[model samples]
Target: MYFTSALVSRSLIKNAGIIFSKQPVPKNLYATRLFGTSLQKQAEAFIPKQRIKSLLPTNNSFRQAVTRFCSKAAEPAKGQKAVGWWLVGCSGMVFVAVVLGGVTRLTESGLSMSHWKLLGEKPPTTKEDWIREFEYYKQFPEFKLKNAEMTLEEFKFIFWMEYGHRMWGRCIGAFYAIPAAYFWSRGYFNKSMKIKVGIFGTLIGLQGLMGWYMVKSGLEDRFQDPNDVPRVSQYRLAAHLSFALGLYILFLMSAFDHLMPTKQHAIEITQKALKLRKYAHISKGMIFLTAISGAFVAGLDAGLVYNSFPMFADRWIPSDLWAISPAIKNVTENPTTVQFNHRILGTSTLALISGMWMLSRKCKLPPRAHTAATAVVIMGWMQVVLGISTLLTYVPTHLAASHQSGSLILLSMAVWLTHELKYLKKLPK
Candidate 1:
């Protein structure tokens, strides 16, 4: 009788289990019943259906639903803000570096170091050390051809200038790398941001190498003739400047992405906003091209060619604009042609930016974007004035450095405007 009773109880328990299993027990049924819905269902309501499907498990949906809530949410808001500020600081460092570079070039101090060191050199300290460094510089073509009469004290001045520039560049690397490693380890960057950070670090490294390569050009034996100025190659100079600009843009745009995320706009305003966006993009391209042309001008000392504005050598066009062989060479290799090209690019950039500003008046832009547009136009005018003033003053170190900085400032404004416009939602008209 006891055995039968035990068997009956076991059979009843097995049947109960079978019934419960066959009834399709919901995953997290306890929580679902308590909350009136599964967590996955709640997640589906807030998250995009397709994204949830992609991230959640087909077999065990509730197991990792919270884990895959939102990839963006992985980064804390505070961390993102900190990263944005960090990028802005990096951008400022690049700005200072560019200005210092311009000063180094203007002061004819770029080639004074004579040697390139990856980690950096120990700057001369003692009198004998200074003399030895000066002697080392004398061995280079720049000293042999141009600064032969430079005294030890004068040598110290130029050496310090180049040293400071190099040191600042090294600082930029440290500033970027340490923070990047921290942010990355702390999971501040999303996948896309990680790729951007990687690219930025790579560019910074290349920039350092390019700077050395440019200086090496001035120290080479290519300046065979006594009359040849011991200066870096125009091509190399332009490339170096372009690389810096590219790196600056990356830093700046990435900062904007973190600091100022896009906001959705109404469909009614889409058409006008789209049109303005196109103009802003074009204006940005023009600004970038103009700044690059200025690099060529600096590379060739083209600003010293014609110290007048709206005219080249007292004429609308210089007779020797195309003096270099193979007309294409004249564009970059010919000083006269380079200056003229820069003038045209600058004026056209100003005009294009002004036109875009006027167009902005017709369309309704986001407040920040409108501010950026205004800043671009104002900066455009200021840059043109600075360029003219620099040329008029025979490229005085102060004025010339400011002119170079102005180009970057103008570019920054254009970048800001374009970035703001890019993030705006565009709906079909």
Candidate 2:
């Protein structure tokens, strides 16, 4: 019985050890799993979705990565956006050139050259050449009629004035053109930007032609009135001034766009709120028209006619207001009428801008729009003061030029205000 019990215990111990002991894995089962896992991973990662690259036109996993439809506007390298600053320099040079042009006109120096020639081919370098140029001027109607008593030295002074004006203009063209081409080649502009700058450059060329065209009118005998002083046509002068102002606005807009591209997308007004924009546009139009009329005033030497403002020579409206025939002629050809119209236009511009500013307050405006509105009102008032001072000072060259520049500044403010309002989202009251 004891022997049988000991055998039973040994058998139980053997079974427990077999159950706990480790066994070797099958070679085929282990290899199958390792190979299958390796294959599965390769399939998951390398499967190209063979038709996807050409079919959907894009990878679904990266919808925002590549825009295939349209080009995105690019911002130039940070702190490397010197192109805008360069454009601003061009704008500033134009400002001085305009003022200098005004001085050239005010001094009666515009007719001195009598001919336009490049500095290289035929600029007068010697005293004898200058004397010969002056002698040539004596044959013109202006020298014969207006300055018959004028001497050669006096002619030289005026010649230098006009020559300086032309030289400055050439410099402006060089400054604006060369850099524009350089930036364009460097891929600084996208397709849309290329079109915009193209237009701007074309206008610059047009302005150059217009300058020559304006001089051409003075060089010819427009009307056979020997009694009339030889001056450029008021119409041509107005056209020139208007073109210059338009060019100025364009440059300023382009510079602003580059410098503050982020602000352009800041606001978008709904149709319901567009009236604020219209009023701003109207004010801008009025300011532009007033500037044009002032050009007529300068052309007719009308400022000299009515030396006193608020009243014209002891009369509210001068008796000679309709000095020219056909009544329509009175606007540009009539000195008295031109001055009267300038005054009216000036006052209307001031009133209209003030009204616009007040109306803007009635509506909720974005912060930028609000600031622009305030500037418009302030600039408008300052312009009025400048105009009155210019008139009261009898159109001194300094005062008149300031008034002209002030008009430009005021117009810019109006345009900017309009732009701000056009894109402006209305805030909640």
Q: For model 2, which pairs clash?
A: none
Question: Who wins the lDDT comparison?
Answer: 1
Q: lDDT for every model?
A: 0.82, 0.73
Give the TM-scores of the predictions, in the order they appear.
0.82, 0.77
TM-score of 2: 0.77
- True-structure RMSD, every candidate: 9.4, 17.1
> Which digits, one per residue and each the tens of the lDDT, describe model 2 over residues 358-426?
877776667777788899999999998988888888888888888888888888788678766654554
Clashing pairs in 1: none
